[model samples]
Target chain A: MIYFKKVLKKIISPYRIAGSLFSSQYALMLEYRAEIVLWAISGVLPLIMLGLWTGAEARVLAGITKEDITRYFISAFIVRQFTAVWVMVSFEEDHIEGKLSPFILQPIYPFWRYFFSHVAEQFTRIPFVLVIMIFLFIGFPQTFFIPSNKELIAAIIAIFSAFCVRFILHWTFAMVNFWTERASAIERVLMIPYLFLSGLVAPIETFPESVRAFALLTPYPYLLSFPAKILSGANVNLLQGFLCLFLWGSLFMFISFYAWRNGLKQYSSMGA
Target chain B: MAIITVKDLRKNFRVSVKRPGLSGSLKNFFNRKTILVEAVKGVTFKVSQGEMVGFIGPNGAGKTTTLKMLCGLVHPSGGELLVAGHKPQSRNTSFLKDITLVMGQKQQLIWDLPPLDSFYVNAAVYGLNKQEASKRIDELAAMLELNDELVRPVRKLSLGQRMKAELLAALLHRPSILFLDEPTLGLDVNAQSKVREFLSKYNKRYGATILLTSHYMADITSLCSRVLLIHQGSLFHDGSLDELTLKLSPYRAVRIELKEPQPKGLFVNYGQLEEFNGCLVRLLIPRETLTDSITSILNNFPVKDLEVCDPPVEELIGNLFKNPNY
Candidate 1:
């Protein structure tokens, strides 16, 4: 479509702008190589959880084994690293610094630039981190397994939707910048849901029936648990997953738009 | 027709001032105090196409507030403003496509990547074809002397280099109008002159209208024939430099080297005589009385040497705002 081409052109037209973003990201990674290694070390949470879960399976529970635990946790680890929400950090920084005005003046929409840079960084992360997981899967074949083509296709779609859901939700939270001077405190409190409900540390199914039902109704589960579940051959209805994703994505889309519109109304240019 | 017009433009902000101290901070948890500050108060102006107008004021004088309004970066509390036939506050895509705002403190360059990368991204955002965007970039870079710096990371470049790159990025689309806010800030004297020269050349070359705000008088004197002086969010003076000078302080300064030392009382009534030594005195005279004052001085004393010139424009602008009708 012409509209799509126009959007694409805008994204690439400022080649230097786009190039700078990628270069900055790569350079940042280089500068913080040690920090990244430390972060990778903190990913020990999943391994710890794997040990706890495997120890409890004196007899196999839901066909889960030491192998299953390792594979599932590693997959969770890989997903968690890849899907980290940087949009919130940059948005909050710009909002607080009063730098958002310059972005608003540009001929192109700021949202697309933000979206593209984040997506581009993800491509970079694949080589730096995702491939490491791929090799891990190769070494631990008993626990980790690749999905079939049909499931892989479905999971890919699910991952993309999940990414959208994550971006929108994080953006919605970042929009809190308009109302409050310090949004990280608010974001920190809000991040509890992603941890408990999104199956980051444990599967959502393991929760009590009542809590599980509530978690399913929220957007957090779609962001993390859905794709991993599909890849693991979990018995989830394809149509139902698609509908759930659509509903959550639409809900966030609505929230982000409203917040952006309202936020713009109160955007005062700071200083002289 | 006016490319930019503003009427009764006003912008006010309600800022929350957090109370200090542990007890005061605790009280702020339940109740907070807010104050309203008017940044731009009922100022108005009109800029036609191809005009290079300077907007100058003291720090916190709201020069930037008006510039931001024209660029559609901030909405005004009360005003009517149209840039390129579009209401700036609406910031419609079409309106944005035709106008560019370059702020010296803020930049669009990707800090870690070559400025060209940012240019490419802007190209995509503007929907320019590869060839067309590159052609424009090449032209702008060449004009800005940015050929070597274009491919280097922005952070690696000097402040002057970064500014040149920023200008190139903003101009890639060749917008019909430019709103430049302190575009030459922090550059060394040589770089400042280069930037001013490029801006003047660009304005003439493309016939691009420019509305620039800066504390740098040199930038105004070199690049803008017409300047708008703002004070306390209001338009204090809006006219060409010549008109401003003639209207504000139509006076000439007279300097004389006396043949012998003279007492101060003799010259005090004529004007404020600034004497570096007993034999040298400088007198300010109204423009109409310059000839009479010189003749009187010559008749009274043996004038060794003499010179007369108008007061600097900056002094006149300062006087105009201090006493509006003066």
Candidate 2:
């Protein structure tokens, strides 16, 4: 319990560490402003899908409305923005290049360091994302309705739970580096399903019924689409969505813990 | 009581030997040859508090393997090792607080950040409050002449300044014991001497026990009072540097500067000529014959200058490992 308390204190007092991490990341982002602008421009797939879905609703195919389309794609965009992580690339590079040993030697756990850095990255990217969102609101004034106060509350909850679910999943995959010499193969295989089923490119509503059923049972939808549904005010079953996200989060957390404990037994700290 | 102890410490590594050529590589994918290399074979040593010991070994001699085991970075396959009254393999916070490892080849500094920032990170990780950490940082910087360099990004600093920062980062916790592996691998003579001076002073001031391993014998000769020489996963010799020198190569050298170049091999009767320059020839004579050989060389050749010296630590240590009974 004392150890836990100490770890908590260090993590929560991020002013000592997180400030530098945020500043450094901000500096890096500023240095690459042109690249960031290019990335934001390329993330127009959601708007493209919005055009198709709104057209379908206008023609009365299954009675989809403009409000629902706005709510769905906007929620998808927000969820997609948060759940995506680059931890796999960082972990694979550190493992292959032998930078992992220094972390092993340090008194602090490596997991927490990665966690703080990821949070810092998210915090730094939020401003740029807000700028893009404001531009979208100005350009597409008639396309999507603004989120109400109640929908805003739901969006917050969904984003929180979505991050919890995705963080554990990425944590579990990062541990796979211990068993395999190279984990890039796992990254390649996981990306396809994650991008599709998680609703980063398109809402799960766009999938056929059979695929939608399978996506619901899997953990990927909770990571992006569920929160997106909430934020867009698409009238999701709030209790059911929370329970599904919670279950996947708990399961991934368990897998992450198990993998970390067992994989440590096999770790060699190569070339230390 | 021993501050650090090890009994039957053993570490084995399974390395896969991949075959070369297209067909052999294809065959290896289905079934590859794996070899078990006994990196450290049941080695044992102990150090009391405040004893600076040098760990010397050949390239594949398992010196680093043993060091990693001591630091808890790698778990031993078999052995009981304790550092600062704690099992290092457990990597307990208390144990980590009391010990530090400085690998000269690997640095802990953030490359893009100033050394001071890296020092601050270390301070946070070690649980040092800002005020206390600052005091120690200033002291270390002063001792290492890093006041000006600490503000510069570590990437811009020379290797020696960067190494000094690495040392300071390792010492911020004021660990009771330190493990230094190749602490002066790449440095100019002045930088190496400065590092040696700081290490010696730090050890003296703190009474911090150190077990330093290095390929450079000067690192051992200057900083380590006792030495442990290892070869091929076993202890070849463990005693004082002087004792090893005396036991392995009991010969003193007599260097003579002839008025002119002597015949190609005329000095065989005196002793074995170790080295020859234009006019200076160095001979290795048995310890008992040192006085007589110097006298004989002075009388025979037109010797302008002569001086007697002991064989270097490297030659003494090399011979000991090369010939076990030497």
Two-chain DockQ for each candidate model: 0.44, 0.42
Which ten-residue region of model 1 chain A has the weakest summed lDDT? A57-66
Give the per-residue lDDT digits (tens) of candidate 1, residues B24-132.
8978878888899898989988888999999988877888888888888887899799889899888888888888988888877877778877787677666676689
Determine which window of 10 residues in candidate 2 chain B has minimal summed lDDT: B317-326
Window of ten residues with lowest summed lDDT in model 1 chain B: B317-326
> lDDT per residue, candidate 1, A1-272, as tens digits?
99998787666556745564455556545555556655555655655666677677432654555555565666566566556666777877777776677688776557765666566555555555655666765765566677689877877777777777777777877787777755667667767998899887777766778999999888787777777677666666778777887887788779888988787777765532
Cα TM-score of candidate 1 = 0.90
Q: Estimate the lDDT of model 2.
A: 0.79
Supply the TM-score of chain A against the true chain A for every candidate structure. Answer: 0.80, 0.82
lDDT of 2 at B263: 83
Candidate 2 C-alpha error for residue B207, in Å: 2.1
Quality class of the docking in candidate 1, CAPRI style: acceptable
The interface RMSD value for candidate 2 stands at 2.5
Task: Point out the worst 10-residue segment of candidate 2 chain A by lDDT.
Answer: A20-29
lDDT of 1 at B315: 80
Model 2 over residues B1-326: C-alpha lDDT tens digits? 79989888898988888878998899898988899999998888889899999999888899988888888878889989999988887788888888888988888787767888777777777777789999999998888988889888789999999999999999999988999888898988899999999999899889999999998888888888888887789876788888878777778878888899888478877778788886888888998887887777788889898888878878766765677553
Distance from true location, Cα of A164 in model 1, Å: 1.0
Model 2 off-target regions past 4 Å? A1-45, A51-63, B256-282, B288-306, B316-326
